[model samples]
Target: MTTNLTPAKTSANTVSADEGLFKPGSKLKHKKSGGFYRVVMLANIEANLAPAYVYESLQNQNFWIRPQAEMEDGRFELVSE
Candidate 1:
């Protein structure tokens, strides 16, 4: 689980960024809101094709799906704890 408080670490999802970094059991943060979240499931529930993730946040304790591209954009980082 990781949340980057500083803007110095993001690079708009560079090619060298970790694409598979956010998977089930991974922790993340919403940079814009500074809220923490975790990836709970990666369902094959595209319903004919959609993003394949369901996440819950510690701040709100609810589940929702975010665009996979946003994770790739360096908004969610790996928490080094």
Candidate 2:
């Protein structure tokens, strides 16, 4: 899986600046803090999800699968090994 550390250019001339997963089968974790949620992209999940399908499942509830991890500001590095 690929974590887009850099910004991605879209056809609309815009870049995706969020720290989210760009690959399929990627594990995305979100924690509720204060009034908003913190989204974290786990390592290797990129290998599971296909790039073409990431956006399709982005908003799908059935697709929002997360694992257990320590909570922080909500941002953490993915351990892809």
Candidate 3:
């Protein structure tokens, strides 16, 4: 199944920029491991509300979640949209 990550709509009906580049269905490559992955969704930690990216490995189909800050900290690079 493919999921599209649309920008969140606010009370003003404007699209929020919080989604950044890692949208659902986007393909990415790990800088260190050189593995490919596909983004599944964006989620927030229940306890602290920290933003995170939910993604699955293209090779093994294993799901993984990483903090948004860490995901964007030069660890992964966009491979495809």
Candidate 4:
């Protein structure tokens, strides 16, 4: 048997997809699928401390997430739910 693979074409959507909706040092809201989200706190880019704190808090809230890249600026940018 043979399998075929193709590369995805680059487009506006693809380019934008590479960029995050949020930026560093911005606040992010806590969100759950099929539900409303709420602003938790103001995110800061303090040596990657903010994201860790946020992740810990979310963990305490029983939120589960797959492994994701660390925020480039060491902060979380607010995202719309």
Model 1 over residues 1-81: C-alpha lDDT tens digits? 444221113343322113345766678877777888877654333344334456788786777766555565877666632
Q: How does model 2 fare in lDDT?
A: 0.31
Provide the TM-score for each candidate, comma-separated: 0.59, 0.21, 0.76, 0.21
Better of 3 and 4 by TM-score: 3
In order, candidate lDDTs are 0.57, 0.31, 0.76, 0.32
Off by over 4 Å in 4: 1-18, 33-81
Q: Clashes in each model (backbone N, CA, C under 3 Å)?
A: 3, 8, 0, 0
Q: Give the per-residue lDDT digits (tens) of candidate 3, residues 1-71.
A: 55455433343323223565687879999999999998877776556666777889999888897888898
Better of 1 and 3 by TM-score: 3
Candidate 2 lDDT, tens digit per residue, 30-76?
Answer: 33322222233322233443222222123443323243223223443
Cα RMSD (Å) per model? 11.0, 12.3, 4.3, 15.6
lDDT at 53, model 1: 54
| Candidate 4 backbone clash number | 0
lDDT of 3: 0.76
The window of 10 residues in a row where model 4 has the poorest summed lDDT is 49-58
